[model samples]
Target: PAAALDTLARSLPVSPAGSAVAIAQDRAREKAHFVQCGVPVAPHAVIETAAQLAAVPADLLPGILKTARMGYDGKGQVRVATPAELAGAWEQLGRVPCVLEKMLPLAHECSVIVARGRDGTVVHLPVQRNLHRDGILAVTEVYEGNLPPAQTSQALAAAKSVADGLNYVGVLCVEFFVLQEGTLVVNEIAPRPHNSGHYSQNACDVSQFELQVRCMTGLPLVQPRLHSPAIMLNLLGDLWFTGDQPVAPTPPAWDAVLALPGCHLHLYGKVEAKRGRKMGHLNITGTTPEAVRTTALQAAALLGIAPF
Candidate 1:
């Protein structure tokens, strides 16, 4: 079992020292180290006990409480408006080690997924504006024309620096908080193929998953080329019907969508569903971002994902 864990750890894109440290702690120390190395991060502090929370400075109010480990897709997270809320938050988390991060006012959120090969070559994926419902990512829109070139470059540089620092050799994701000032700050990092990169499957020549496989297998990283502007809509469990004899329903009619040029649909082979769970996604590509957005919304609406 230890060998299995070691093999799995070796497959990750982190240095042996960093990986060992990460395996011992609840959170990845490499993330914090990256933030400290000229990468802007959401202001935060680690807390292991109620006393530490009590002693936190007053300026850090309106903060997000997150478990140091095993948190994802909005789970293991809570918001605290004041010190009075800290005790309850810690209790709710079963007294687990956690981090308190200052609440960031975001203009918009985006992510940059990168692939770095063993030779230290890096490739950046297209930037995607993300939409989340109740902390769960639900949709992503790839801006075709109106993207801020400088911010995209900054995001790419930050991702590369992180990867190079860790000697990362696979697909890694760097999420950003696009502030009103047009600055991109590092939000979090995922050292694997991410859900937000799903749009690449239909939108780009190389999907993030494929890139990861290539990197892990020692293949040279391929630059991702966007063929068309695309929009991705996530399918959630709420769309499925609930009954004693539940039948695996087919996706809503794509006749209208297929009629539109460049429309694509993909369904993951998931057997069951629970409320708010990710099921699959629809990617629609078109000549323009607006057209792609419009067609994607229509297709998602037809699939019973309302208010597109």
Candidate 2:
């Protein structure tokens, strides 16, 4: 697809050039790029052959073996606890080129979304605190003080460095892991608007979608300001089922959900509902962080989502 986009960009302008796409598509290249940009990343090895697999360092065990390409939402990944599991994990992945990364102790996960312009100007949304369920994004919280001052500054700087390193020209998301020891390490990158940034739709003056258009059309990119504290809860297809063994899918109590103040729901027009599939998201914004959290919790209770 990058090849096709590269060809198309020859005559028409493209927001994100193919080179950036290529790097984000491969985990090995992504990690290399992060390191080149002076961002810390997890220790890992690329195993494409038996010799390389066998040569993996002992310390890297209890790691995650992930395919270098086409992996998302925890797919194409296997958690290997020891060297003995590496071979089978690789086999399970169909012997594809993979990156084995030492799993680090994490206190929490957060992400930053930056929009870069052709003139090299970069503006970012506030850092987002994220929660993942079953490897899929479950919730995103964005507000002042959601993260510590030092970690916020660090994540913002690293995200900008990555965008500038690629000479990137679009909305890009960089995810990071906050270690228990207060260290920060880059996890991955997404070349377009990300699920974590979805809260910007209602919480910011300029949404990521509009920012993407600006970057593509050579329009001026303005720094987006958060107008209110916000929380976004991902609505998964699992909500469509009620009982433990339901015979048919049932819609949630949207009327009750909408009755809550500051509750905004956006549903994707998917024809079928399957377990683990993303159906929509609920964004709650309010004048105060306390109010937003309370309303969001009530919304979650109504939707059967566990409290944060």
Candidate 3:
């Protein structure tokens, strides 16, 4: 799907100025583009060949080897604990064009969804705290109280900065890494609705999808406002598997999950589920973080989701 999206996007009529090259489509290009726009990012090296991998500097050791494109949910990536692992990583990733990024200590991960009109007007969603398992998003907690005011301000400014720099005309999402020392670095940018913003459908005055429609159709952009504290759990295909095998998965007990208060369910309607596939999500809204977590935990147990 990632490859398909890229091909489809590239086939459309594009701007000669490179504005159509959305950073979200390619990690290597995104990092370079962010740097060109004066945004801070993790230190990394881009290598396009096995020779480059063999010559990688020792300092970037304990780094991650990532493909430049079509990598998502932690797929097409490998972790190298030392310089010696670089060659092995290159071999592991099939000697593709890639980035070797020093793994930084992260305090947490968060994402900000920014909507910009064709006229340059912009607005952002409430910052959301995210939890991931095996490179796939597991949960997103959102509310004004979920994120510290200062960090929220920083994340919003950073997201908007990239959107403005690209002269982006639709909903754009920026995933940020909050280091242990409290600095924020851009992880990547997405040109459309993101998993982290799914809670907005039930918890915000304006969802990212709605804003995207408005942006693309020349309508005025509306500032999104959070209506509740919410938590969203991504339902991946692993839930359908029996044990670790790919056998037909036991259908999740939908009735038990829906019985929870303020719990909303969304299924993608795909006929077959396979490993790492995104099937749907559960969004739980409540008056407080504790309440959101409590309700979401109940639904997770029913849906067979791993605990956050």
What are the Cα lDDT values of the candidates?
Answer: 0.76, 0.94, 0.83
Cα lDDT tens digits, model 2, 208-268, are: 9899999988899999999999999999999998767966887889999999999999999
RMSD (Cα, Å) of model 2: 1.0
Least accurate 10 contiguous residues by lDDT in model 1: 15-24
CA lDDT, candidate 1, residue 235: 77
Model 3 ranges off by over 4 Å: 1-22
- 1-308: candidate 3 lDDT, tens digit per residue: 44454565576622212443445667877898889878789999999966777777777878988999888889889998976677877877888789989899999999999888877899888998998889888999987667678788888888888888888878788998999988888898777789999999999999988988888777888898898899999998878875865476666888888888999898999998877899999889988888988999888887777777
Q: Deviation in angstroms for 281 in model 2?
A: 0.6
The candidate with the higher TM-score, 2 or 3, is 2
TM-score of candidate 1 to 2 decimals:
0.87
Candidate 3 yields a Cα-based lDDT of: 0.83
Tens-place lDDT digits, model 1, residues 60-93: 7799988898887889999999787977898999
The TM-scores of all predictions, comma-separated, are 0.87, 0.98, 0.91
Error of 3 at 131 (Å): 0.7
Error of 2 at 95 (Å): 0.8
User: Which RMSD values do the candidates have, in order?
Assistant: 3.5, 1.0, 2.9
